[model samples]
Target chain A: MKLVPTIRYNVQDIITKTIPVYYGVFTLIFLTLFSMSKLTSLYMAGSFSGASFNSTVLIVVIGFVYTRSSFRYLTQMGVSKRTQITGKVISILLISAVAVVMDRLLELFAEFLFKSTEMTYEGSGIAFSLFDAYLSKLGPVAREMTLIGLGYTSRVMLLSATVFIAMLYVRMNTAAKVIVSVGIPVLAFVGMPALAMLIPEQMAKLIHTIAEITGLSNGLPIRSILWMTGGTVIFMMLYSLITRRAPIKD
Target chain B: MSSLELIGISKSFGNVKALDDINLTFEEGKIYGLLGRNGAGKTTMLKIIYEMLFPNSGAVHMDGHAIGGNDTALGKMFFIGEKNYFPEEMKVEKAFRLMNDFRKDFDPAYANRLADAFGLNIKKKIKSLSTGYASIFKNILALASNAPFILLDEPVLGLDANHRDMFYKFMIEKYSESPFTAIISTHLIEEVADVVEHVVIIRNGCIIRDEPRESLLDSGYSVSGKADTVRAFVSGREVLGTDALGGFETAYVLGECPKNDLPEGLEISRMDLQRLFIQLTNS
Candidate 1:
């Protein structure tokens, strides 16, 4: 069936309503830290990293704010829940992708303005190396483009997971919703690091094996990136399935 | 054979039963009034039909197809509940655009005309609109939906007299222009009595009266005279209700009063929809 109209409406709603509200809050925090001189360029980079890590969590929070009456309103207006859910997920991804791209571009611009190009590291760490291996299967130009695309896609998937989780919690009571909303990121932040530390030797060996198989050098960032990206994808899939069966309030 | 049908529908919240073994049917091209007191299962029935709420037992069907949560069945129906479902932050025009995108039969021109008629600002956010205007906006959306089976629960709530009149006029006009089945559940019986062809009154989660308006009116009569005379005249008849003020009395009787048998100084009139509704439901 033709799905463009529903997608367009949903995307526009997220762009105009959800994204602005979210980005506004983020911007306010960014400006406040910057103005206080409490956030140096290093802090900016760290915050961006934190944002990327919690991207799904951010999207879920925003989704919770908008999904209840907004989703129901669309349904009441004759849009099917399936169409709405699909459109919403796509819109969340698009917004997340756009936000990440904008942040990276802004970071590059800030580096140039601060005359800190020498101090800045453009390397993608293990993430870039693993991506480079896959990219090398294509040519050099294709590799660069694919790397950029993967970065963008990774960010989008993370955000989409958040939106899915938030929508899933739509039918939950206020306290339970807040718990789930806050719990996802807490689990991600605490759980991943704890897992990594607990199995550092095994993780290190796995990284070495991956590096050897990909013909990459030791200490490549690709292994870390793979772990993070794989975790994100798994989280997103689980979130989508949970939301598909989520109880909606009438 | 029926445009809409419900079979053995049952719903409960915790231990309280909202609907119990409810069965209803609606024919095409007729306006039905779903009248009920508060918490009498009218909204629950409508929601079940629209698939917003699932019946704990039995099924709802439309045109021989089950009205589940599928898009096909949902596309053929429309429901307007008491809640203002629009986002509080959305502008009127944006809301219209959203509606147009979702509902295939949405009439943008009609919505615009209603907006203009009601003096609703297209740029104003829904949260900013007055209560009356908010209801006006919702009514306009319902009117422009053009669905075959439209369920409006208290569509005239919070509307001023002028707007309520306009709403009725618009409903009649829309019905004439394109005949459709409409179920309007409202407590304002008199406001819609003239336009509605059928009346379905529910009391305590059961169908107490379901008949054509003409048939209902034909079966009941209002007798007014001196207290003693009216009481004596109505004593042998099925008395639905009685209202006695000082020495005068008016009794609403359920059966026909023959023209040949006239009680002295007693005046008898045909029961209108409002009186019939009051007499039948007051108990």
Candidate 2:
């Protein structure tokens, strides 16, 4: 529908602005890590480390920037807020997919240049630094790409949606904005820990339930992806609510 | 010939009412002058029509469909707003490329021609342009858009007299070749005095005056004479304001001239758009 053009415009805008910042931050961190690794390897034998950026930072940055100015630009172009919300989420999905690929390439390059990084497993059987771990077990190539892409996409979109909503929530003058801003820190700093202490093994039980539902220990990413997809939809609905009558700031 | 109607439109920010119960219709192909003083809800009205700011109540319609969420309908009108909404780093020509993506009827050749006329360098980034050139850049976009409706808010914000004259002439030329509804909001009332066919003046969040240029001009007449004679002549009529000095006074009267023999030393003159605006909007 109208989302097609909006997506094209937003994706272009997001990538044009986002990529440069992403690469700039990544290069600074990577080169600093490389120099540190070089200096450390000289003194300490068997000390090895290679750095690659967590593309989530880029997604978060782009999300903040979109709310900061890009939405104003698109809205000026006659884009509806609904279309903008949808377009931005889709843009994040595309950016995340592309960023994941680029990130993996850079990780591989970093590993090649700096040190060795093998896909290792913890005792719980969760794979980290994934490399060819699921090629034989995860069915066809397309399905694997879908699983991986959707996983990256959902994570990135979650951050993008959260950051966007948080930025926009500040724009509201409602009491709810004040409540959310005040309540979250209280919950994190004082309430959660107290709740955890009051209920025996409460935090452990919660994490265990989440793990079981995600099939994390069972090594099935589909359940986690389905949950992430559900989360993404919920965030989109929230975005639609906040932005239905959102005013472009002066 | 797209018709735009704002029925009972109202907007506010916090406790301040920006526009209140405003209704207006922009018929096709006629230029309108939207005149208001600073913070008189002029920009707010324009922003509301463009859906940049949602109204607290009422609706905006173009040919009967709600324009708030309709991009295709919204696309039919291009607004040359006061502020820079485009990304700061984008070059002037790149902005045209972006505009091309949104507005289908944007004439790149015509835009380039206008840019050339203004001696604007298309390669310069928008942020690097001076205020006058920035205004020129936006004006070029709006003129070349060929949209059925074009809203210009302070379109000649920083242009010199020569450039402003050139803009007015070219605006008329563009309208002549391909007609469209243009609503220009500005403080420089006298500049667009003859260029616009209709006048809409807002004051303190209300539409105080909305009428045709000729009728509005004819609605008021200023009389200057001896202070006593002026006061006597304006005794029965609605006098907007009066200026008095050493046995002489000038009284601005509203609602048509009295058809009577003028007393000695009493004279009447037509009220220009600017004077009419000043009289009507004086608060």
Candidate 3:
């Protein structure tokens, strides 16, 4: 009945669980890369992109754990399933936005540090955020907009994958769980690619068409944002269908 | 007064029926002890009432409104189960704060005081707690929740003697301060016998007894003496069970003791709740 507290609690939970690890790993990687730049003549680049990638991974993990962990805890607290699922959706969006902002901040921080310190070093440096790495040709405003779109799309895609897997795992028996746990990755990494080999041209065309429609091929991700938003809704509906009457298992 | 009712509730896992066509009601402002043997569906029934499990037929209602996915109705009840549901990395105090966030009446001060009384370090992560401490932590949360209905499944599962004693004391203190409905489902019937005002015994997924504690206890009496004397005294009476050791015997009989007609050799005593439960639910 009270949506705000549920959403607030879930957001706090996700942030408390993942954000610290994100920042810790970011600091470690940044320092490691900075020290390497100081010791060698090689140009150090792509640090911000690496941070963004890590954030995406963290979001994906959050999707799975939110269902596995928060769902159980909240249910025990007498939160209805609808409230839990709604909290989860809103929490994902909020945390994903936070991750995007953190990515942008990390980019700025890295750029300032590298550029100011380049005069003292033997090697030059460039800190390319995901946007710079992928869409450097876009103007300043377009680049920022594309970054927002890219962040939303990447998080939605990963969240869909992990939430689908986690929900199916929750609803399944031991044997089905084991099979699914082993089957999904194999299907994605080996089976799909292998099947694609039998129809390389069609697969290639499909990929290209997807990229074109999403505007990623043209260095703009505006359409991808709308498409991924739609994808998120569909994934959320599937999550609800799976969990509406689902009982908590041991 | 508010009441929680289960009408024709049934649940099954594969071929095993955990609960079957059961109807029950829990009235407000009273303590109820749900007595059942292992696999007698105490946990399953409680879970279904808490909406953690869905029943195959019928539904749970609070004040005549279906509680299936209704947040307002669900929010009125808080359930603490044997397993830890808090995030493993969450600290005890943080959990208290989170509870406060969710339940408007949650008393953080009371929870902290209870934590101090239990010697539970507020900073310790839930995963680091030993078995007894985990139970204590969950119990403390339930006691401080201030929800109208609190369901505890195996609330004393891992508690030692002293802590269990302290918990019962605190539970009574809290309930006296503000009366709320509590349904405590546990295997340790004796420990809760004095605390529960009402008793419900489940056997083979069906409720065989549900009544006030005094009435349930009054339905049986035990006689102990020499084997032959005890048997002779209980002869023609409704016998629930008997235990014999060497020349001594104790016969559990289903009826009030005729206090004035006590035989010379046999000693008559009120049957304890544990013995009654064991006799009634024994296969």
Candidate 4:
């Protein structure tokens, strides 16, 4: 069957209204990160440890804003439920990809302006580490592309969870929309680690063993990635099912 | 096969009954006006016919097949309500694109022609348009969709007289080119009387009067004269409604009034749709 025009229109709507807003926010985030990196260098010399905090804050902010805008557009368009959800998924992926690329570019600019040193390349740069890992698993070109693709997908899924949670309370009102937009990401950011700590010692040991097999570790970044991905996926799946059957008054 | 049919349909909201034991049928190539007062269950009936709301009991059928949620039968039907349901941020062109996608028979050229006719700006967002323009754009979409069965609920609510006339003219023009079934639910009976063939009057959640407009007009009569004279003439007759001014009284009575027996200065005229609707609904 041919794709419904509503889907195409909704996608176009996402590109027109949602993307620009997100790009604007992303620019602000990149600038903020750049400044923070500089400040960290000035204070601690070689120890710039607030990178994770900056990245998390930026991702959550962008994700929440985009999700709220997307939901409003989808509902107002009178798009069917399936198209709304699917269009949102596609939109999230697109925005997330742009955000990831912007983040990397900002990192590169920081490295160049602050370090100001040229060195012989043994492998890809620090920003390319994720891409290199994916390359090692897949191949040279495919792996690099796949890593970008995966990063985009991961970001989209995580943001979709925020969209879904926000939707539960704000499906009908703008005030609720704002509340959920800010609430879900903050909860996910702060709540996941606390929940992880609640795991029993034996279960933690078992999880650690499994993490080793999967090349995961107790490293804060890896643990945070796992938490974000797992939580977002579960939340998104549940959200999708709920929204699929949600009653639409208009 | 019938173009549309509703069998034993019933619906309720909370404790209030919106529709009760309703059945309706429509053939192809005919225009029907669903006439009713506000809250007379006209919208509810239309919603059920379009499968937007499922009946608490019974079923709707199209072409001898039962209709359900997401039914293809709905593809053959276009339903426009009083509200502007299009995305607020959507441009007129984008709305057209959506119509073209969901409705297989949508005519883009016709839509554009109607847009030009109505002076609607294609680049304007739906929310930015005036209420009249919004109604015009929606009417254009309904016309362009080209669904076999078009159901309009107060489709001209926000339109000015000029646009309303333009809408009826366009409808007639389109109907002449390709005859299709339409059921317009509106309170503006007099305005649509010239084009509408059949009228279905609803009252208290039921079809009270469903007949050809011509037949209804032919069968009803209005008598106006001196109060005593009109009263004498209408005594024991089926008087639908009556109005009095000073000593003179005007009475709308169903069935023919004998010309020979009328008083000399008394006036006897055939009832029109507006009178008929007022008589039917108010009584």
Candidate with the greatest lDDT versus the true structure: 3
Span of 10 residues, lowest total lDDT, candidate 4 chain B: B67-76
Error of 3 at B163 (Å): 1.7
Which should have the higher lDDT, number 3 or number 4? Answer: 3
Report lDDT (Cα) of residue B120, candidate 4: 96
Top model number, TM-score: 3
Candidate 3, DockQ score (0 to 1): 0.68
Instruction: Please write out the lDDT profile of model 2 over residues B1-283, one tens digit for every residue.
Output: 5799999999888899999999999999999999988999999999999888889899999998888787788888888788988888889998898888777799999999999999999999999999999999999999999999999999999999999999999999999998999999999999999899999999988998888899999999999999998999889889999888999999899977866888878999988999888988885
For each candidate, what is the lDDT?
0.73, 0.78, 0.83, 0.69
In candidate 3 chain A, where is summed lDDT lowest over 10 consecutive residues? A121-130
Docking class of 2: medium
Residue B105 of candidate 4: its Cα lDDT?
84
Q: Write the per-residue lDDT of candidate 4 for residues B1-283, one digit (tens) a residue.
A: 4578888988887898988888888889899999989899998898777654557898888898886533356667777777665657779997787667666789989999999989999999999998788878878877888888888888898898998999999999999999888899998888989888988888878888788888878878999999999999889999999999999999999887576866776899887898888888895
lDDT of 3 by residue, A1-250 (tens): 7688888877775677568777667667666777777788887654233444346677767777776877788888889988887877777678878876766666565555566444322111212322244556778797677666676566766676678678878889999988887898999999889979999999899989987876556544566677777777888788888878878888
Tens digit per residue, CA lDDT, model 1, A1-250: 2246766765676677655666566556545545444434454433233333223445556555765665667666655556566666666667667655655554444334334322333333434544455654677687555545555656665565555555666657789978877887988999667877999888788877866654455433354446546656676666556544343364
Candidate 4 chain A least-lDDT 10 residues: A116-125
Off by over 4 Å in 3: A13-17, A20-54, A111-139, A197-220, B224-237, B247-249, B256-267
Question: In model 2, where do residues sit more than 4 Å from their true spots?
Answer: A1-4, A13-52, A107-150, A166-170, A173-186, A198-203, A217-219
lDDT of 3 at B182: 93
DockQ top scorer: 3
Arrange candidates by TM-score, highest first: which order? 3, 2, 1, 4
